[model samples]
Target chain A: MLEIKNLHVKLEDEDKVILRGVNLSIGPGEVHAIMGPNGSGKSTLSYVLAGRDGYAVTEGSATLEGEELLEMEPEARAAAGLFLAFQYPVEIPGVGNMTFLRTAVNAQKKSRGEPELSAAEFLKLVREKAKTLKIDADMLKRPVNVGFSGGEKKRNEILQMAMLEPRMCILDETDSGLDVDAMKLVADGVNALRDAGRSFLVITHYQRLLDHIKPDVVHIMAAGQIIRTGGPELALEVEANGYADILAEVN
Target chain B: MALAKLKDDALAARLAGLPASAASGWLAAAQTEARARLAAMGLPLRRDEYWRYTDPATLNAPEVPSAARFEAGDEAPAFDGIDRLKIVFVDGVFDPAASDDLALAGVEIERLALAGQADIHWAQGTYGVLEARGQTPVARPFAALGSALATEGVLIRVTGQATRPIALNYHHVSDTSDAILHHCVKLEAGANLTLLESGPGAARLTKVLEVDVGEGASFHHIRVQGRDHERRAATHVFAQVQAGARFKSFTLTANGRLTRNEAVIDLVGPNASAHLAGAAVGDGDFHHDDTVFVTHAAPECESRQVFKKVLMNGATGVFQGKILVKPGAQKTDGYQISQSLLLDEDSQFLAKPELEIYADDVKCSHGSTSGAIDETALFYLQSRGVPRAAAQGLLVLAFLAETIQEIADEAIAEDIRSRLEGWLQRHAAKGAT
Candidate 1:
């Protein structure tokens, strides 16, 4: 389970509050969609939850399965069954993708005191997961995210989330730069990883990705706060009209 | 003896007492000239600009007597399966019995002293000079010392269209338990040679190698300095490359108490190329210095210099590289990069890369960076269940892999990698215990 209680976060080195009085809760087997206009603090929520540096938590708390998430390091948060599918993955030159992914996975397992995987076993599992995501075998051998297309990088992020099999996954604008086919493929990868004991919080500005990944709850956020929560119809309503109507009502 | 008290007469007397077999007329004249120069210049002090980073006083003492003869009947130098002509020099004396006949179809591999009589033009033109255009006062002492005590060296000649590579193996072993100097190596026109020079004992040795690359010729020089723990060694390599010729030199210094490998390369002809690369790793109380000077004297010439140093424990390492472009050397492309990784806070590294250009149309750049291993990379590895030591070792290995990637020979590169791993393990264990 994941819980965000009146979370108030600000951009680093500034007094500008980005996420103000935000509250959300999602249980096992539930998919929550957070849709908002530009600068609505959608990506900031993901980063704050992932414990990235340079984000000041002005107030409130984030807890995952009763463990404090904001106080932990990014790597520590990752080891505690939390995964963030970055919108724009960083290109780490000279660090092989397979090497990077294996390190991350084994790091989580090591932190949990799980047995480490041998090279052969790791390769077998990685190849299987990569095949499901349609990533080429040679891509694993290259530097992380180096020379990858926009769509490929997004898909690679999803592939990593799947490989880690986190208990709670955050898909931040996974469909922003993708074409129709790429959007379908990415959504399908996320759908495949969904399970009864796992949760997903898919954040986007459009409803196109939701056509493939249906969510149980839809929340509309504006001015750093979630003002409306409804069933799946809320996504259709925002898609048909836009955020202006919702903004007028919230104001 | 105090270098100030070292008179020409005393030097000449010592030179005269040397075995006749190791003496040559040209060598005798060089010793006289060097002694005269040393007398005029005197020994360099710590205040000298060139010796600022390195103190020559540690090496200054009464000159030890030259060993009478090289200790013979030692184990042969290990080749690790690389096959080429082997020319052996033991204790500054040519070892004909240990040397192979190296009578390839069109190549000739012989001692420089013997070649002086067989082919006077090639030998004299190659080994005649001891001029290093930009050498400093600090280097003057060692250069003068090596020149004053010149002995046998290798002479390799490859005729036109020769396909085989000539390997020159120079090994120095101390039999008289004293220090000795071996000077000069000459490679002739159209010759393709791979010189593998190794010093494999606890004897104090000093050697100077001079190479002449004729027009359109190619030469690859691989020097591995592996001296004993107590031995103090110094190597000076001077190379002159002619039009359209290529000179590639790689030096690896892994063990020594006080070692300096200095290389001076002159691009004398248009379109000539020089590739100079070196890796030096020092542990414990060892001190290693690699100084390189590359001069672009002709238009359209290209030169690259890369040096990497890894120091552990209380060891110290220094890399000083300079790229000089002459006025008329237009369109010259020269690049130099020197990087150092200090494994611990106690280890120290000093890197200075300089570029001086007089040509208006030239692309010359030099950069020097020194830092510890990446902390993020370290944590990334350790988080993956790799023990702390193994993680650190892997990160360090990857850090040096950039330099190793430039090696032309994969097998040689792998061998160097294994040696580096072994070194890391030993040092890590020592640190652990």
Candidate 2:
């Protein structure tokens, strides 16, 4: 369950406004895809919800499970079950991928007052999850995202999402640099995690990814606001004819 | 010149307080030569090009500034887990009761005080030879001072592969002790040895370690400068590596008021390899400097210089490194990189990297960079549920990992890593976030 109402945001260092009073809500187990043209504030919405820096939420609120997400620190938001799959995953030269994942998992567990996983337990679980994403031992041993290809990076993000098991997941342009096969693999991983207690906000530019993991609903956004809301067919319409027809009609 | 007169006055004042040594025969001759050299060069001054980034006032002062001994608090001393021939020193004086027997299988070891009294010995040829050679391009008056005035040290001669490392453990007790020590190590042809040194010997310390790696021999040196925050030290490592020989040296420095570690390595034979690396973590009131010069004189030699520093809360770090490839030294591969991770705007890092190649076929590359923590990487880690401080600590360790990998021994590397982790945890509690 995720909710965003009248979400207005502006760059912290500049006066330029990005998201302007956008409203969206997703219920439990539901998958929603947001399609928008360039600079329409689709990615900004995800960043604002995930509590990223460089953005000032001028007005409105975004909540996860009735908890104010914007007011919490990024780590607290994560502990409270918010996950953001970045378009370009950061490449950390020194921190190994396995170490990063383990630290994150244990940190969340400790913050939640749950027992931390032993090294053996963690290794087993991560290996199982990685198997589905086709991430080998070497990938897990290497530094996070350092020298990783586009497809590998996206898949690594998916693996992290699976490991963290956040209640609400936001994928910001996860399909941008991935090939069709990689997209399908990532979609399968995401589909396996879909259940009654989990929700997804898939922000994409095309309908090709939606084809792999069918969405329950689709929203067409323009100029910082959601101009239209429909079913999966809305994504098909956008693919058939670009956003030009829809933007002109909405104006 | 006014600069020369100032240096002369400073050197004279500092030399007036030296503790007298009863030198004789060959040792007396060496000490006399070293004293002449010091008198000619004088102590370093702030205006000198060599001491540009770091001030030499405190190191040049006559009176030793008192340093409070650090209570490591339940942390095991460095290299305690390794099997080594322990030679202990307290306040720069050899502690025979605390040291092991002066005997090892493949090496001949003797104290400098005992060996200097002998009329003739193998160490007489190397006592200050490397130190004098290292003073040519740069005037290291502190090293000359140590060689001329030191009353205690160790002399080691290796003729075969050493079964275990030789550990020089320094324990600081007297707050006002001014310690000077000189050590010489000669590795015979085809021999191998590893030397380990640790601790803050005294309030104001000057140390010189000269090593000669003979043809086809190998020498490995690892040092962990003590954690006394108010201590000031000037340490020098002068090494000459022969043909087909190997030389590797690494140092880890934590908190100290002032620390200058200078390493001068000369590769004189073909196919010889040398590596010099250092990792330092400094907090407020800390100043750490690593000055290294490596020379390649023979064809097909390789040398690498890697140094990294982590500074926060107004701490300062300096690096001056140079690599020279002489004429006819074709196929020389030299690499140098110095980097700093400044945790805040108040901290500063200064670096100067130089490469001189007379042979056009040589490949020498050098890089120097100072940067803040990668914000994107930090945010990514935080997004995964790691707290801000823990994430930063991880990144800092990662930054130092490249330099730590230069160590040939895995156990020693692991020990160093744990020590760094302990340092990070202690500082993190002081609001590193």
lDDT per prediction? 0.73, 0.94
TM-score of each: 0.72, 0.98
For model 2, what is the alpha-carbon lDDT of residue A179? 87
lDDT of 2 by residue, B1-433 (tens): 8888898999999989886667876777889889999989988998888899999999999999999999999999999999999999998999999999989998999998888887888877788899999998889999999999998999999999999999999889999889999999999999999999999999889999999999999999999999999999999999999999999999999999999999999999999999999999999999999999999999999999999999999999999999988999999999999999999999999999988889999889999999999888999999989988899999999999989999999999999999999999999999876
For model 1, residues A31-99, the per-residue Cα lDDT tens digits are: 999999989899999988876656799899999999999998666777788888877776655568897
A170: Cα error in model 2, Å: 0.8
Give the chain B TM-score for each candidate.
Answer: 0.85, 0.99
Residue A158, candidate 1: C-alpha displacement in angstroms: 3.9
What is the DockQ for all candidates, taken in turn? 0.11, 0.88
- Our model 2 lands, by Cα RMSD against the true structure, at 1.2
lDDT of 1 by residue, B114-217 (tens): 54344234555444364433244235556666655555555556665445445455454553333344444444556565566665322456566777787888
Worst 10 residues of 2 chain A by lDDT: A43-52
> Which residue pairs in model 1 clash with each other?
A107-B383, B1-B62, B1-B63
